[model samples]
Target chain A: MQFWIVQSLNSLALGGLLFLLATGFSLIFGLMRIANLTHGALFMLGAYVGVTTLKFVPNLWLAALIAGLLVALFGGLLERSILRRLAGNALGQVLVTLGVSFIVADFCLIVWGGDPIPIAAPTSLQRPIVVGNIAFPAYRLVVLGIAIITAIALHLLMERTRLGAMIRAGVDDMQMARAVGVPVSRLFTTVFCLGAALAGAGGVIAGPIMSAYPGLDADMLPLALIVVILGGVGSLLGAFVGSFVIAIIYTFGSALLPDLAYVILFLPMIVVIAFRPRGLFGRRST
Target chain B: MSAAARIVLVLVLVAFPLIGGDFYINLASQIFIAALFATSLNLLVGYGGLVSLGHAAWIGLAAYTSAWLYLHLGLRHWITAPLALVNTTLIAGLFGWIALRATGLGFLMITLALSQVLWGTAYRWAAVTNGDNGLSGLTRPAPFGISLDGPAAFYYFSLTVTIVAVWMMARLVNSPFGAALRGSRDESRRMSALGHNVWLVRWLTFVYSGFWGAVAGLLFVYYHKYIHPTALSLTSSAEVLLGVIAGGAGTIAGPIVGAAIVLILKNYVSAYLDRWNMLLGAVFVVIVIFMPDGIVPGIRRWSARLRKT
Candidate 1:
């Protein structure tokens, strides 16, 4: 029972970080119909920037915020310069982003020199929180709390705000949304930046636990994509549910079926995909 | 464009091995193998309208199968090659059935996921695969009593197989079945209305392409005398896709040309440049942005315009 609880909590931490990464990816994919492969590169950038910022800022939260904002700014520039030109061309979108990612990954390697480094956890959150005979890393609890808050905030933003309505309208029909005077292009840039920022935040939070590395982009991109696809391509709720399921599968699958863990990890996705082609919460049309 | 021109091109490639000595012969062999891989990928992307991002899985699968069979079962390359091709086709058929149940992005994602599963197995299954250390020091098989040990001999063997494969693909794309696949790609509902089995067409295409991709892997193992998990990577898949796009999809000669360009850049240009990836990325970006139709079609259009002028 104790082992199960601890594993479950660990899953929660992993799931939380995944949620941030997948939601942004899901949103951009949903609205833009672009795979945004560079989002993973942005996540790596966030982690690296966070690590760099830690040397100067001395506050983990502030450094993370700065890092995420910088990544978001870069995402906006990417949208303005490259993605804007390739509208409605799916293959072009995929290829261009892939190229950009390659360039960014190489650039990261040049700058960071291919070493795995971790951002230090906040001093306050460094201690372990105990319950009866069980003890958990306090930083993990912070991650869980941050994730929940971020999810709720995103939910409210999408569900309640005017911009959310415009985004939803655009997602449904870009032509109709444009006819109604919604600034679709600017909105796309904004949504893309928000998505990048969220991905960066995921990296920052996951940095202490997973470490910042050159290959993190490649490793996390697939995981985030799995989360997005499993959750349902454009559905926030689907992303949340998918993240938890995947994180649990990854954690417990490793624990239980050490040898065939990857097979076990992909099993749920295969089963889920077999039944729900559009994903758990994805619309049929999309 | 003319039959005479095509014949001349083929003659040049064929005769080059005889005259170009060792380094060029080896390089030409690599290009032919890569061309074969790209051509197979183009069959799906160009004719079938299925842009698979995990096409390297097929190549990786066959490479591993050939290597394993040779190492463990003491099988000849002649036997192992056919087995590898058949094995790849079987796996492709299975995965294609599942992937084709969904359309567009779902299809791409499913293929990517399936390939990742294979890569994971290759990375983690250490006892059989040797994990990251990779399998090396393989010898070329003397299939059909042909000597494929030397660079010259191997080049001719690879060239012969590639020519036959390319010819087969050329014939296939011009066939009634190829017409149907193209029809399904452009007008799926119409093709279905006309009583064509659209899903079946795609599934068959996937399996067929897998056969060719596996053949590339077989050749790669024999040529390099080694195999690694990197063969199964997303980068390998991307490189093939880049070749397909650069040469121009939906054409026989385009992917071959693209493969030649890519391999030449990798082998020759990278020798001088430390930042080869950045250069490659810049080139790809330029190609996508400017020559979106690809080099072949782009040149054709320019020539047509020039003729008119």
Candidate 2:
């Protein structure tokens, strides 16, 4: 019972982090047809930046905020300088992102060395909270809370804001959006930055649980890829559901059938890809 | 581009290990293996326009199968080699069936995800794969009573296989099927309307590519006498893709030159520099921005324009 409870909570927490990563990835893939392979490296970069900021600030939220902003700024620069140059060349842009990912990964390794950096939660959230028969890590619960809050905030921002409407219009139809004067090009940078910020902040939040490691980008990128692939690009709901599904499979599959975990996880994905192609919630038209 | 140049190039590569020093014969063998692998990928990416990111898994899969069979089951190379090739090709069929369901980005992602599945299996399944330590100390094959135990012998072996493989690819490229493949890549619906059977064409190409990729994997194992999870890594796939792009995806000469450049830069430069990966990344960025058509084709265009001027 205790094992199940822990695993379940762990899955939920991981799902929350994945949501932060995948939502941005899905949006970037939708708005711009390039797969931002650098997003994974960005997550790693954010974790490193968060680790550095934590040394000075001592506040988890402040560190996360600073990490998010800096990473966002980095992403914006990438878009303006490189991605923008290869506008319609999807493959070219994707390759450039791959280059950037490599550069950033090496940069992180050089700066932080090869050791994994353990980040601590704020003092208030350091201790576990007790329930009837089981004690839950307060930090884990806090991560879940942050995920929910982020989701709500994102939902509200998307639904209630003019920028949200414009983004939606652009996502639906780029040419049509431009015809109506939606400033789609600037919006592209904005969306890219937003995605970068979310992934960056999520990295800080995940630091306590996963730690800042050398190959964190490689470890996390596949999860984000699976989420975006399974969830359908540009669909927040798909990312939400896909995150939990993949997280549950990843966590429990590792715990129970450690050897056959990938078989269990990848088998369903193969089946879905074979049959559905568009993913569970993918839009009808390309 | 002329027959005389092609013959000269072939003669030079064929005789490289002889005059290039005994130390570099091994390097030449490695380069040939990579070039062949790049060519196989070009069959799909360059000709079929099916850019797959997970095809590296096929290389790892075949290598693992052969290694495992030899190590645990005490099987010989002649038996294990064919078994590994067949196994990898069959699996590629299944993976291809799934991956080819979507076009463009979806297809690319599915291929990547599925490869991750294999890489994860190799990484986590310690009992079979030995995990991070990897499976090592394998012996090379001796075909027709000729032992491939020395650098010169292995170089000839790699050279022979690569020559035959490239010839096979060239024949396939000039066939009517090749024309159909290009048509489908350029306009899928239109090709289908013209009764090209686009999916089947792609499926066949994927399996064929897998076969050659497995061949590359076979040489990889014999060359290093080892197999590891890193063989199936995304970096491996990216490297092959970059080689294809940098050389000239559609041209026969492109991948050959590209692979040679990539292997030399990676092997020789990494020996001197710790930041080789960053340089590699920079190469990727620079190549994409400036030489997107690849070196061979870009050079051809430049020479053409220069002549016109």
Candidate 3:
């Protein structure tokens, strides 16, 4: 019973990080109708920033905040300059972002070096609490708590706010939203930065567990893609549900299959997609 | 553009091995193989209007099959070549059936997930695949009782195969089936209304591209004499994708030109600086932003302008 509970917590911890990343990815995909491949690189960039910040200030929260802010700014610039110009050209957007990601990844490699650098949790959260027979790390619990709070916060922001309404409207129909006096150009920049910030925040928060690595972009991209697809593109609830499903599968699949874990990981998505081509929560495209 | 000009181009390419030294011959052989791979990818992106990000999976599958056959079963090149095509076509059929259910982004993600499945298998199945360290020491086979041990002989062999394949692809693109595929890409609803089976066209294109991709893989393994999981990686897929976009999509020869430019840059630039990916990324950005039609169409436009002037 204790082992299963601890494993479930592990799954939640992984799911939490995935939730943060995929929510942003889905939002961007919903609005732009383009796959922002550079979002993965932003996640990597966030982790690197966290690593650098930790060297100066020993606080995890501060380091994560700094990392998130830095990447958000970068994301804003990318949106304003590059993405805005490309507009409706999906292929062009993909290639441009891909190119940006390559440069960013290489720069990270040059600065941080190739070795995986672990970002240590704060001294306060480093300790483990006894749960039944198992000792679960306090930081992992903290991560789970943060994820729940963020999910709720995102839900409220999207549900109650005028900005959220505009975003939703834009996702439904960009030209319609624009014609109705919604400043979609500015909105695009805001949403993109917001999404980037979330991914960066997820990176910093999960950095201690996964560690900052060179190829983290490549590693996390498929997971994020799986989550967004399973949950439904642009739906926060879908992203949340998808994250848990994938996290549980990953946690258990790694334990069960070990070597064939990725294959196991892919199977559920394939099955899900075969049945629901638009994804579990995806809105059908006209 | 004339038949005479086309014949001359082919003759020059066929005779390249005679004038070029061993190094040039090897480099040209790699270019030809890359061209074949990119051309196959173009069959989807250019002709079928599907941008599959995981096309390298088929190529990698065939290469690994050839390597495994050579290592474990001692199967000769002649036997393995046909087997690789069958392997690729079967997998393509299965994956395409599932993936083609969704269009656009969903399709791209499904293809990516499928490739990762193969990548995981290659990484995990250590006893058979030799895992990440990769399988090496597969020698060049004597196809039709002719030894391709030397660089020149192998180059000629590769050239013959690539030319034949490209010609077949040209024929395919001009056929009635190809017209339907193109029509579907431009206006699927209209095509369907006109009695064309859009889904079947896309499926057949996917399978056809997979077959040619497998052929490219056979050439790749034969030339390099090794196979690794990296061939199945997202990076390899992206490289072929970049070639298709940079060369200009919706054109038959565009991807081949795109592949040549990219491979040349990779080979020549890496020799100078270790940050070739950075340079390549910047180049890609420039191309996408300014020359969205890619190098081939961009050149064509410029030449057309010069003639008018």
Candidate 4:
């Protein structure tokens, strides 16, 4: 029973990290209709940037903020410059993002070399907390707390703010949103920035667990894709539930059935997609 | 292409090895295999309008099956090769039925996810696959009593297989089924309305492409005598797709040219440069920006306009 509790906590930690990476990916896909393959690369770039920031300012939270801002600026440029040029060519746009990702991945390798860089967790969260005859890793609990806070914050922004309302309109119908003077072109840039910032911040948070590595982008990209596919695009509830479910499946699968882990992982995905091509909670395409 | 041009191209291919020595012979062999592989992918991307990112699954599956059988069970290449091709094709049919459930971006994601699953399986299933250390040292077969142990001899053998494969594919694309496949690519609703069974068309195309991909895998292992998880990796699938698109997805000869350009950049240029991936990425971006339809079609359009002017 205790072992199961420990595993469940680990799964929750991973699911929280996934939410940060995938929420942005889902939003970008929902609004722009582009899969935004470069989001994974952005996540990896954020970790490296956060590591560099830690050198100047030892505060992990500050480093994460700086990393998020820088990554957002870069992502905005990418949207305005390259992806904007391939308007209406969906496949071409996807390919361009792929090209940029390849470039980013190679540059990361060139700059950081191939080894994984492990970032130390904050000192306060290093100890394990005991509760009800079981010990829980404090870092994991903090991660869950952070995820819940971000979730609540995002909910408030979407439900209570005018900017969130406009973004929601755009997700529902870009043409109608434009007709109502929503400034969609600028909105595109803004949403792209927000999504990139989330991924970058998530990257810094994941550093203590995953580390910055050469193939991290490749490793994370598929998981995010699965999350988006399993969860409906632009649905926060869907992303939340989907992330936890997938995280639990992956964590327990590796522990229990190490050899057939992936086979088990992808089989349900294929079955679900065969039945529900639009995802369980996904809305009709605009 | 004109008849005279085709004849001259074949003649040059036949004569070049005589003058180029072992290094060029080996390089040329690699290109032929890649060209064949890229062409197989084009059957889906070009004719059927499906961009399958897991196409390497077939190639890797066939190669590993054949190599592992010979290594562990003492099976001969002659037997394992055909068995490998059949097994891969059957599996492709099943995967295609599942993947074709979604069209456009959904199809692309499903294919990518499925391939990732296979890649994970290959990396983690240590006892059977040896877990990424890879299986190596397979014996090359002698066909028609001719030894293929020599690089130049194998080059000629590969050239024959590539020619035959391309010829068959050309016939396939010109057939009634090819027309139906193309119809579905441009208009699925209309084809369904016309009683075409678009699903069957795509499923068959996927299986046919997988069979040809397995053929290329046999040649790949014959040439390299090695197999690894990287053989069926997402990167490998992406590289083949890149070659197909860059050459001209729908054109027959376009993939050949595109595959050559990509392989040379990957093999020849990488030898001299430390950052070939960045160079390749830049090439992808440039091609998308300047020549969206790819080299052959782009040149054809320009020349047509030139003639009109």
Q: Pick the candidate with the highest TM-score.
A: 2
Q: Model 3 off-target regions past 4 Å? A: A1-3
Give the per-residue lDDT of model 3 (tens digit) for B208-235. Answer: 9889999999899888888888899877
Per-residue alpha-carbon lDDT of model 3 for A194-255, expressed as tens digits? 99998887889989899999889887888898898788888999899999999999888887
Residue A146 miss distance in model 4 (angstroms): 1.8
Q: Tens digit of lDDT per residue, candidate 1, span B237-305?
A: 878888999999998889999989998988877688677666666777888888887888888888999
Per-candidate clashes come to: 1, 0, 0, 0
The estimated TM-scores of all candidates read 0.96, 0.98, 0.97, 0.96
Q: Where's the lowest-lDDT run of ten residues in candidate 1 chain A? A: A257-266
Model 3 reaches an interface RMSD of 2.1
For model 3 the local lDDT of residue A98 reads 79
Compare the candidates by DockQ and give the number of the best one: 2
Going through the candidates in order, what fraction of the true interface contacts does each contain?
A: 0.34, 0.73, 0.62, 0.64
The predicted structure with the larger TM-score, 1 or 2, is 2
Q: How close is candidate 1 to the true structure, as a TM-score?
A: 0.96
TM-score: which is higher, 2 or 3? 2
Compose the digit string of candidate 2's lDDT tens values, residues B20-58. 887799989999999999999999989998888887987
**Better lDDT candidate (3, 4):** 3
Ten residues in sequence with the least summed lDDT for candidate 1 chain B: B273-282
Model 4, docking class:
medium
lDDT of each: 0.85, 0.89, 0.87, 0.86
